[model samples]
Target: MPSPCSSPRLLRHGPIFFAAFLSFFVSLGTLPAKAVEPDEVLQDQALEARARHISEGLRCLVCQNQSIEDSAAPLAKDLRLLVRERLKAGDTDQQIEDFVVARYGEFVLLKPRFEPHTLILWFATPVVFIVALLIVVLAYRRRSAAAQLPPLSKAEERRLKRLLEDR
Candidate 1:
């Protein structure tokens, strides 16, 4: 009897399947992995380092969760170039970051600044985590306490033994 694993469909399509698998990864490898192009790199090493540092903390508006430095989005590329330009113009890292925040709001920052509006965003995770931990600990304690039975009276023990014996 032929095993189900040795299907005629798989044998017939095997070469095409292998070719497709190889080509998929090859196409992916050909794609530009980083957002920053060669032309975008600053001539001054110090300025470039500062630009990279600032970009690393800025969120890519297109990618949403990825930092501008790590994202391949066109918006991320623009932001990276903007950072380098700002650095060349003698802007401090904080000033450049502030300028971005002013234009894009706090959402552009990977680690949002703690301000009146963003205070909740800054503290909500820790507060929720602590509350959940407390609830879990309390629930565990209640379950364990309920599981700990009180000492049985001699009469009750004798009755239980008799019930078991009868069964």
Candidate 2:
């Protein structure tokens, strides 16, 4: 007998199932649309590209976590405009980034700069992992040591035997 999973009814709908699955994955593969407006775009391709590249690294202050390139926030729009104005003035990418950082502090950067204050942020995960590994190793060793001890004292063994006989 054929299994229910291999029934003609299910097989008839196989193409529909496959089409739905393919369309779902194709939609997922598409990138999220940017929120940049038409008027906001720079006239110069090179300057626009640089502006976009810089904007991608900037955090949207209002949105908290979204990059300026992706955010719909008013602050993100302003930041995008500011990046364009800086590009128009012939600022280098480093200079533009420094200007934004000086005005907004490091929190406005999508990727924070490495500094003495951020040393803890950089090293915390490894320190935690090593500590957890040591704890796990110590626990396993203690458990193995306890498991290897002799089963019982002679008196305890005799007591257990007496209990078993009584039962």
Candidate 3:
């Protein structure tokens, strides 16, 4: 019979034990809590879900790091209602987001559009990195070339020898 400390038994039982433990631990947060308030969400579940998805991607103008949907500030509430109203009016999610961005500037959209002004936001970092790499490469090459200079003249070597011997 295999010893108690054998590898096969441990390997076979380890993952099963760990998985059960994780399932038990993770289930602590999986239970449903209090239901959503009637005043909180609009009548339409799908529309409200869409609005939430969009709003979660939008920054609240008055709140610290809170999305418009989560923020209770007047501006956030206004923006949330505006999103729902725009959805009811049949505006696509992108269209509603674009409307909000146009009104509030790119700061409203968590991920700004990659247009002319924001193109630099996309390209400038890479360009700077490439230029810096090129400069480093040139500097390294220059340093290496400087280190590879020809030996000193025979006269200079003789003078050094004489100075050292005389001293």
Candidate 4:
């Protein structure tokens, strides 16, 4: 009997099955996992939408890389609730953000404000890159200059000739 691997149908459909399997995982990766529970949803659609927007911009302190909207941590849920409460209390989006920032400090923001304290955070990478580039350029210039030997003096030439003869 032919093995399953040797079946004509399996050979014909192998690539199709493989592609389907790959696409399933790819789609899963692209879909955001929402941690919002049904009870946490507000009856007011506008308020809920604003809360979701705010949650998307706030980082989960426990999951440092994930937005609170996508995080399942208890702290993330609390933040989501807080945003909704602030919205219900007639706070503007900016006011809600300010309140959260005041409570949690700038670290809770996914994108920090451009303040004097954060200037170094914003400029550090570019400054380091420019300094590294300058170092590389200077090193390359020095290497090229060193590679080109000065014209040999007459005495040096004679000495080299004598060494070559001895060799």
**Taking the tens digit of each residue's C-alpha lDDT, what string does model 4 give over 1-167?**
99999999999999999999999999999898999999899999988998999999999999999999999999999999999888989999999999999999889999888999999989999999999999999999999999998999999999999999998
What are the lDDT figures for the candidates, one per model? 0.89, 0.91, 0.83, 0.94
RMSD of each: 8.0, 4.9, 6.7, 5.1
lDDT (Cα, tens digit) per residue for candidate 2, span 23-132: 99999877666889999998889888888899989999998777899899888999999999988988899999999999999989887778999888778989999999
- Candidate 1 global lDDT: 0.89
Candidate 1 per-residue lDDT over residues 56-134, each given as its tens digit: 8999999897889989888899999889888888999999999999999888999977779888997999999999999
Best by TM-score: 2
* Candidate 3 lDDT, 59-148, residue by residue in tens: 888864677766777788778888888999999999999899889888887766788888987898999999999999999999999999
TM-score of each: 0.70, 0.76, 0.56, 0.71
Q: How big is the positional error of residue 26 in model 2, measured in Å on the Cα after superposition?
A: 9.1
Per-residue lDDT value at 156 in model 2: 97
- Output the better candidate (1/3) by TM-score: 1
Would you list the clashing residue pairs of candidate 1? none
Which 10-residue window of candidate 2 scores lowest in summed lDDT?
28-37
| Backbone Cα, N, C clashes tallied per candidate | 0, 0, 0, 0
Runs off by more than 4 Å, candidate 2: 1-31, 160-167
Give the clash total for candidate 2: 0
RMSD in angstroms between candidate 1 and the native structure over all alpha carbons: 8.0
